[model samples]
Target: MIEGALGDLRNGVSRIAHNEKIEELQSEFSGDKPHLQHSKPLHLDPMFYEALDVLHYVEPTCLAAFLKLSQFMHRVEDVPNTKAYMESDRIIKWPPNRW
Candidate 1:
């Protein structure tokens, strides 16, 4: 029961995050209109906290995977050569060390 509730909460938060991204992109392309900017730090802090809240209810492996995926997505834009890595048809190599 608690696991289900936590899953729902996670899904709700994910939807909010997705909507915020969509709005930002629309604003960027539409030009000259103000768009709601989602606070990354604010959002992330709450998200991490919420994840922690339900950590006990969730499987350790699942939680670890979720966190890893979230971290990857958050750092996607800032990583060097991200576009090249994303667009490559062949296997792309990453630096031995990343930020």
Candidate 2:
């Protein structure tokens, strides 16, 4: 689980870095305020879809790991308790009074 989580995080970070690189390249080529032609989205880019597939595979695992990590970190940092109020007794409060 730890390995999978790390792998997914690594992949996600790499993807973001790649995207930033692409954006930088585009900006370098097309100066400030590049004119984007309003046209239908290109459907021929299989790479785009392939990236999406990788994201789909990694997203859930990444999210779960992130949540776990966040909780862990929070515990380590001794974050304040923020839980909402709860009813005293679920069975007594939820059921009908007649019962």
Candidate 3:
């Protein structure tokens, strides 16, 4: 019975979180103005706290939310940036030399 109740609670919270993210994304991308110019600064403290909680508690909903948030924050690959690193004389040892 307790397990079922917890499952239901998790499902409900997940739905709410998913809906909120949808709303936020819609509002962020709907306007005619540039997203970066008008959008509010993102606060990352709560995200960090949620990540820590997920790490400690191992909750499914929190973990899913964290993963989704991480996906949203993902950046595209930069070829130029990688080129600079590749051209640099940085010696990288395979086993990393156990310290």
Candidate 4:
């Protein structure tokens, strides 16, 4: 899980850095502002999608680990059954909730 998190982090950072360079070049070569040149819906942005994908994977793992750790440390009386919850039919929306 940690490795998956790290991989996602690395991929997100790498994509952002590459896109930043692309934006810089676009701005230098165009009269319009970089943001204007890249005009698209927020949902269409690669970075935004990548972040959502990363959070989708990482959040559940972290939550499960934390719950297990809390149980091990006697911080909580009982850890909820994460496996069952994950297996259930559920639709979890992310940033809209975060926002």
Writing each residue's lDDT as its tens digit, candidate 2 over 1-99 gives 868866765775586445635444433543443121112223322233233334445463543433333333233223222112122233232221211
lDDT of 1 by residue, 1-99 (tens): 868865776785465444535434434643442212342233443343343334333443433435433443444434356446556785333221110
Measure candidate 2: CA RMSD: 17.9
Runs with alpha carbons beyond 4 Å of true place in candidate 3: 20-99
Residue 25 C-alpha lDDT in model 3: 54
The list of candidate 4 runs beyond 4 A from truth reads 18-20, 25-42, 46-99
What CA root-mean-square deviation does each model show from the true structure?
Answer: 13.1, 17.9, 12.3, 15.8
Cα-lDDT of candidate 2: 0.37
Ranking by lDDT: 1, 3, 4, 2
* Over 4 Å off, model 1: 1-39, 67-99
lDDT of 3 at 94: 30
How far residue 97's Cα lies from its native spot in candidate 1, in Å, is 37
Per-candidate TM equals 0.23, 0.23, 0.22, 0.27
Total clashing residue pairs per candidate?
Answer: 0, 0, 0, 0
Ranking by TM-score: 4, 2, 1, 3
Give the alpha-carbon lDDT of every model: 0.41, 0.37, 0.40, 0.39
